[model samples]
Target: MSAIGTRAGTGAAGWVLADSWTMTRRELAHWARQPVRIVVGLAFPVMLLLMFTYLVGGGRGVDGDHAEFLVPGMLALTMAFGLEATMLAVTQDLTKGVIDRFRAMPMFSGSVLVGRSVADMLQSVAALAVMTGVGYAVGWRWHNGLTAALGAVGLLLLLRFAMLWTGIQLAMVAGRPEMVQAVQILVWPVGFLSNVFAAPESMPGRLGAVVEWNPMSATVTAVRGLFGNPGGSGGSWAAAHAELLAVAWPVALIAVFFPLAVRRFARIGG
Candidate 1:
């Protein structure tokens, strides 16, 4: 190849790596400056875990260690809560013209979106660690051993990645910071309407059936199964469907939303 061609190839490769790195570093720096957000994110679920396990988890006749039952549900909810952060960041970038600046720069087109997803995954991992440590402090145990524990973690990460894409797509569609709050109101219903805090069977007839099929419900059920937690409504369709839906739904969601998020990013500031 010509010397100019060689240089061009090297530059292209460097830009790809550097763009991702720059985006990641920028996100990390932003988090470092606003550590309170991370603290609040971790604390919110921990408080819910404590309240449910002590106040309602035991009194409701849910069998099993309450902490054990609560921990897996909290893990799933923690991931659901992270969507707000993703939406906020993406919206802020859009409104602040940061994305417009990125468009003018010579960088890999895919890097910003990929980097946002990766950084959010890392944040999820940190939140998981904090929540797990708190769970242990409150007497939760994993009787199913290391493999199952790792499997549960893997499921949580998969769910986070899928949700991150959804959040990004929402931010792109909304295109303003003010819209993030309106969008976030949808999260609570989607979360509480699931089996996160109670068994589907315990819900009212029609509501129970819908909760049984919720994607978050599938994840909570599968993780609880993996963790050997009790009160999972054994022998139901959810029990049978949990494993397949837990993996497949997230994969399918990412497959649908990821490309859409990228397309939205391309059209930003246009």
Candidate 2:
């Protein structure tokens, strides 16, 4: 009897882990098959990075090497870019009845959503690595120590995780792939309103104040601080508060959205 109980417990644990792994692998395979989309997603940010660094960068009171200032902003933009892919995948799964099929399976019920989030984060990591390489090619370098470098990576990952939940929530609400485009339209303004390309001080007063406080701006400010880039200024409070806000805002967003996304996933087709 004791041996049977122990065996049953181990079996259950293994089954749960297996379900999660299977879901994660399935999503990863889908990405592998869609290499072109991945490339396109990555290329846009790199193009923007180059265009801003070489073209618009010099005119904006952006002191120091533009690539360095631009890299941090591009990092935030890349996270924003990832949301569309997540929303599209989730919406596609729902519309094609793939999610329904998963619901019918005996696998862990939450695994599908968890798997998508994991796969997307892996893609984000790859995208970040590629962008970092591109930044290096264009003369961006991290002047901070290794610890600060790692911290910047951590900030990016946290930001991606927060955005992932937001994407999942959007997917749940969208219910169809076609709706993702409409959702993506909202992302552009959020990206543009942030201090990504130029200093907030250069903007008109009211607009600059808003841009300085935008969450993406906080992230850019924090990353620029980490890189020792000089673009962050104006609103002395923001300059002092960027790092804490960067960490807190993402944490708060994830805490709120993760549960909402999970609950939404649980109610699919209900």
1-270 in candidate 2: lDDT tens per residue? 455442344576687787888999998787789999778877888888878887787666555577877898999888877788888888888777566788997677888887888899998888889989999998889888879977888898888899889888988898878789998899999988998877888889889888988888888889888877667577657656999989988999999989999898888778
Worst 10 residues of 1 by lDDT: 1-10
C-alpha lDDT values of all predictions: 0.84, 0.84
On a 0 to 100 scale, what is the lDDT of residue 214 in model 2? 84
Candidate 1's C-alpha runs over 4 A off are 1-14, 58-64
What's the TM-score of every candidate structure?
Answer: 0.91, 0.91
Tens digits of per-residue lDDT for model 1, 33-71: 999987887788778888887778668875557788789
List of clashing residue pairs for candidate 2: none
What is the alpha-carbon RMSD of candidate 2 to the true structure? 3.5
